[model samples]
Target: MRDPRMSAIGKGLRRRGRLMVQAVSPPRRVAPERRALNAVPAQRDPRQEAPGATPAPRAPRLVDSPVFVLSSVRSGSTLLRVLLNSHSRIRAPHEMHLRTVHVRFSRDFTADAMKELRLDRQELEHVLWDRILDLELRHSGKDVIVDKTPANTLIFRRLERCWPNARYLILLRHPGAVVTSLTDRRDNPDHAAICDEVLEYAEKLEEARQHLDHAHVITYEDLTADPERVTRGLCEYLGVPWESGMLDYGSHDHGRFRPKLGDWSSTIKSGRIQAARGADASLELPPRLLELAKAWGYPVD
Candidate 1:
């Protein structure tokens, strides 16, 4: 039987059945008298209470055409990022993780106060993210900035809303490869959970590829196979001259490659673009994964 307490949280799952699994702490015990007080609804934010509240104006964006690389984890985005970072005019820094950085409305009037200044929680966070990108661009002495956070694929729509003029690089890999990579890297790997995660990312990647006006699709297999050709095309899309140094990214300083920030494996440290591994045919793929593999032009048979 489902716990009555988790009923509200269960509603958070999308109708399509995709869920980002998270650990939920057990409910805490409360005194009998306190339970009644806790039952009282919290005060609604002013914007929610106001009837017919029009859309609030937003602050101008700081970095208009910042590039975003949308890919699943272990999809070779770090490699793409470093190559771009090696370019003279592009700065691809460690994951800024703008989604994790947020603004909170503590007081009931906080929303009202921000609305007066043409700001809301989301817009304020966008401004802060833009400022961070601007700062990183200045530090790198580069004219263009790119964010290649793997998790960014989950929030591609929000990112597009934040920067309407943003450019996207939809990086793809074989679903079987993604599942194999994640399973090998995680400590206590759950194959079921891993496939679910890969599917979530694959769905979002496909959505972004279909929705975005300026999305450039690239595959991990092709990236390692012919980096010079792929990167030259990327440079052309980014409106920058193609520099041969980008092909030899090993010669550049692409910041620290550590856990959480990016792939810190020996393969990346070797300062070489190694060939991507083909899918593990021995491992059976889920139906959805098989579909995506075929959709992305990979042989699933």
Candidate 2:
């Protein structure tokens, strides 16, 4: 009984199986994986070995010379940067926060202590160094490259470890007023945290004074009220001649000056400060903070 339907079904089944077999078969056989492909072996660069094993070291960084203005957030650091940059011989960038960068490279940091948050150390350092060089080139490489990162106020020792010869400028403001400025932020989740940071900065500065010899402390009030006196002192400290323009900082074109406090550029553009009114006022400080501030020779009142 040769059923025509049965015949067709058998033929279809055979065809399907053959196609399945073909699909399962391996494509063309590839030559045994090359030894080089089997593993990633180190390959020496021919050019590198031909003469000098290493490319001539990058032209030494534009200059190893780094000048840092260390202070706390909301402490008139931006104003300091603008005033210093007004000097034709100096390029002071808005806060680069080098201390925040340095601490991440270190392991001895106490998470519970006063040191503020850390940044990506290697990347931040590289970016900052590049920017410093760019500023140097722009200014014909004459003046110093100053970085006014407030976080650096707490981490000066760490920075000196990374750049042993770096110069430091310590800027201090009254703690009570600094806390008041921080508390104005009604929406900030970490406003209290900021207040703590201000306290931490005061503590670290005390620790810093014991080890830092090349640093000169500049009170924010002094710099704002009597810039001539403080700036002259700074120039003398740096061995730079006092420039008249430094005294008349308000007239300088700071259109390009970047304020680290975000868009608060107008706050500093006027170059007028209210800190001076209380500069000589004797305000109560936490007993500990008071001791530290006074140790730095801050006016007790």
Candidate 3:
């Protein structure tokens, strides 16, 4: 038999010869039809960290990929949602009211509804976020989703823990007006006591500021007076392109939430400013509320 050493040398030489042939040969030109199918032209989406065409090594986390709009109730969050919804890539909810009622009502709702609704404690914390992203993909056929819930601003610290990459757009209305709007009901006529609710919101907001890193605040007055400028600033902050029609969200019919059968529905449909700059002047707020506003950096005028 041939020596074992000789056999190994011949095998190595044969492999080298094959490699040399490959290096020297002219590449076979692909047919026109084949070339078209094979070509992958360079395309980019600045909003996406990577093009959807690229396969991620692993699935991204739910929280890491969601956009959240956080603020107190009736603080121009509806307007913000309208603007954001105008974007081709964004789908938003009108008022999810998830945080306020989701967790708070978890125990009250029957365990059967809880199980059937798919809202456990963890899911409740991120209900609007989950629904916005999932529905945008299904209905709006977009990847970017806007969760424009006002109470989210107060409870974001709890949310941030679950979704560190959650982005926030804060809506800051005049405290007096916010309280006025909330406390205007005939049964809820305790104007001074309403300060407790406003103070609680401020306390939570301050806590959110201390704990969360990815947040920006926009005042309601600034938005109404210069919607284009404010909306553009918000887009820039979120690394999105600003579109002009975002100012006209009052007309878009996403049909997410139906206002109750009452003045609330009529008021929302009217799209008029419910609270003006001096709306609080006619109402009597407790001195404690004025003090709380002053302490929280809200002008007491």
Candidate 4:
């Protein structure tokens, strides 16, 4: 027979070991609904749900019919942006380069990757543009938004694919003048490369005009020569009443200049719309650019 005291001690140790094991063991999983209910409500929150119940679904996001100002750089896109922004219902912001963002997304466009992500090419592109435009509209507290990304002309097809109802304002400037402005800002003396860029931009713009049904052409020369007349026409195209104050863009706050977006926009800071001086007569245009200018309705001579 075992000693009584030793038997008691053995029983005590067994009980303690059992208690320790239970303490360290993982707890049972709570249901998803239960977990959601227990989550701490965010600060100043109004919504509340019963414990162990599903929360209400959120409302779908609203995206406005956007107006795009498409053009090549140094072609008066910035000036037009300021003029539109001055309008009461329109909020035109600086270049947001949505096309660049779309290009980045395209890198991962393989079939398998898209399947894994649960989004097709069009779906992904739509989501990106929608989110950007929605944020801009909310921030500006405006009913209509105008985005002026000069390179956007190159991606008009893609934009149409995403926002079929979106309207476009295509701004055209003399190719020679555009290149002159571009080269003036940079130290690079290679006029050939700059000319090539201008021609490519014009080609894309022409293509967009041909394919898109809702595009309106606005020449930079005409815009500067008669601000009121050009802007009134733009308002008619946009289906909004033209505001007289739009002519005084200098009085409105267009926000600070962003150097990274493009330094060519610095002229808008002058607070007044100046008449467009003729392009430097001495600046010679490459043969390709000269031909493009003539085709686009700008005189080469």
Candidate 5:
């Protein structure tokens, strides 16, 4: 038999010879260019972003000399829209709730929410209102756009901020008439709710009155009583020449109904501009609303 010691010595020699061969051979080395290419890039501060990186999105193009009609709901805003749209120079579309749109973007105008969403209040307003009014102007082929959203009375200050040069046409109606009209449109009439709305409308109208330079108040009663005279005066306020066609709103094609807007404007869809007579003769005004109605030049005996 072979010597066990000799077998062990032979195995050790083979292991040593393999080690020597590996050591003598050149160690595997990455190419210099490959090493440079494979090296990790240096970290960059986000604040010091690379030049020519994507720029922040720009705000939308705003309208020139934009006109807005402000009022509470059921205050003849739809009539105002049709009358204004009838003018050759002005294009007034259906109620575009721009304030509500702004609220949707900013979520109650919270600074933290706006910051997180990467939007500024004025920027959001510009983007939304611009897109809407611009589209309306294009469609109507009119020089200037008039937005007749009654609820805009609530956000008149915000609108001023968005368009410092904007002109406002504020429509005022008797609180009883407004409340009665609103109640009629509802499936269930909630007196307390209607009272609250009347109070809110009064408050907003008062707020709007504070800015008399930009705002022109017209009573719904007067508008219905004298559409020509009232609309002509409105044209003067807007710095536009009055056209006779404005009185004939039924002749033109006002667009389809926008159900997104409240139901108070159902009559305007007929494209007619007849005055509503005795519409509010039946509503008994609450004392609080009666007091407000008197303050707003409404006969509330």
Candidate 6:
């Protein structure tokens, strides 16, 4: 038999030689697809957090009970907003588009860093949203602030999550009228796409009206036909007394009426509480539109 010591030495030499060979070998080239995957960071959505992780404890908000007006585009939300802003204790600014604001974790360790502070990406965004509401309320010298972004209808659930104590105002308009306004205002409007958009908002609004016990529902027709009664009820719902001055919104400084920020059409800029144009009864409605309208108590005939 060979010497046991020589055998052990030979094994050690072989292991070291293999290591030296690998060290000198060129690094393996990463596949193109793998390199591309590493180049782009994963998108982090506020709605989606790591599964099975406990949500952070709720933090106190400076503006705890802010109001959000949920409605479809061209649904007279701007009219409602201006009317509310006219009140002494209420501040309703142009579309804040808070839903569009987002946060990104550029570094792999950043999310973990935030986790140490008892906050996730969603919680951080909630804090930012709360700060925005508080800042606007403070600046306006108003006790209550209302955000009348019509797009709020799309992400109402997220808003509710961010502000559990938040109040909601559901604004509705005849589906026909919304469709008409969209087609008229938008150049080369896609009729099918417009209907889809209206249906999407309507579905969400109906869901909200059904689900939220504290929500106040209003329609464009009722608001224009009897401003006093409707606004008095609104004041009651919002814990404020009726102010006759709210009707004469045209006389108040409601900031600049402009496009994208909110409604800026000549009709809205007129600052007059004009009667809502009656939707054509002859206009044939899609089955979904008819269904939603009937559900909301609008006449289908």
> Which candidate achieves the best lDDT against the true structure?
6
Error of 1 at 156 (Å): 0.9
The runs of at least 3 residues in candidate 3 whose Cα sits more than 4 Å from the true structure, single-residue gaps closed, are 1-63, 100-132, 185-188, 260-267, 271-277, 282-292, 295-297
lDDT of 2: 0.61
lDDT of 1 by residue, 1-301 (tens): 9897688677655533553333434556753422422343333455644667664565787788999999988899999999999999999998877777766688878887888787776687789999999999888888999999888888898888888899999999999999889877777777787788789889988888878867889999999999999998999899999999998889999878887788889998888999998766777778988988898898868
Q: 30-148 in candidate 3: lDDT tens per residue?
A: 53322322343232232222345332222235435677776666566776676677776677756554444333342344434644654344454355545545765677776677777
Q: Native-vs-model 1 lDDT?
A: 0.83
- Cα lDDT tens digits, model 4, 18-109, are 99888764755643312422333222111122355332232223564688887887788888988999998898987787765531232433
- State every prediction's TM-score relative to the real structure: 0.83, 0.62, 0.63, 0.73, 0.69, 0.83
Give per-residue CA lDDT, model 2, range 138-205, as digits (tens).
75444677777666665576566546667888888777666666555334425445445567877776
Off by over 4 Å in 2: 1-60, 98-131, 134-141, 185-194, 256-265, 273-285, 299-301
* Ranking 1 against 5 by TM-score, winner: 1
Query: On residues 96-211, what C-alpha lDDT tens digit does candidate 6 reach at each position?
Result: 97866667887788877887888888888889899999999889989999999887787899889889999999999999888888777776677786787788888999999998
lDDT of 5: 0.71
Assess each prediction's global lDDT (C-alpha) against the native: 0.83, 0.61, 0.61, 0.74, 0.71, 0.84
Clashing pairs in 1: none
Pairs in steric clash, model 6: none
> What clash count goes with each model?
0, 2, 1, 0, 0, 0
Q: Which residues of candidate 1, in runs, are more than 4 Å off?
A: 1-54
Candidates sorted by lDDT, best first:
6, 1, 4, 5, 3, 2
Off by over 4 Å in 4: 1-61, 102-118, 262-266
Q: Is candidate 4 or candidate 6 better by TM-score?
A: 6
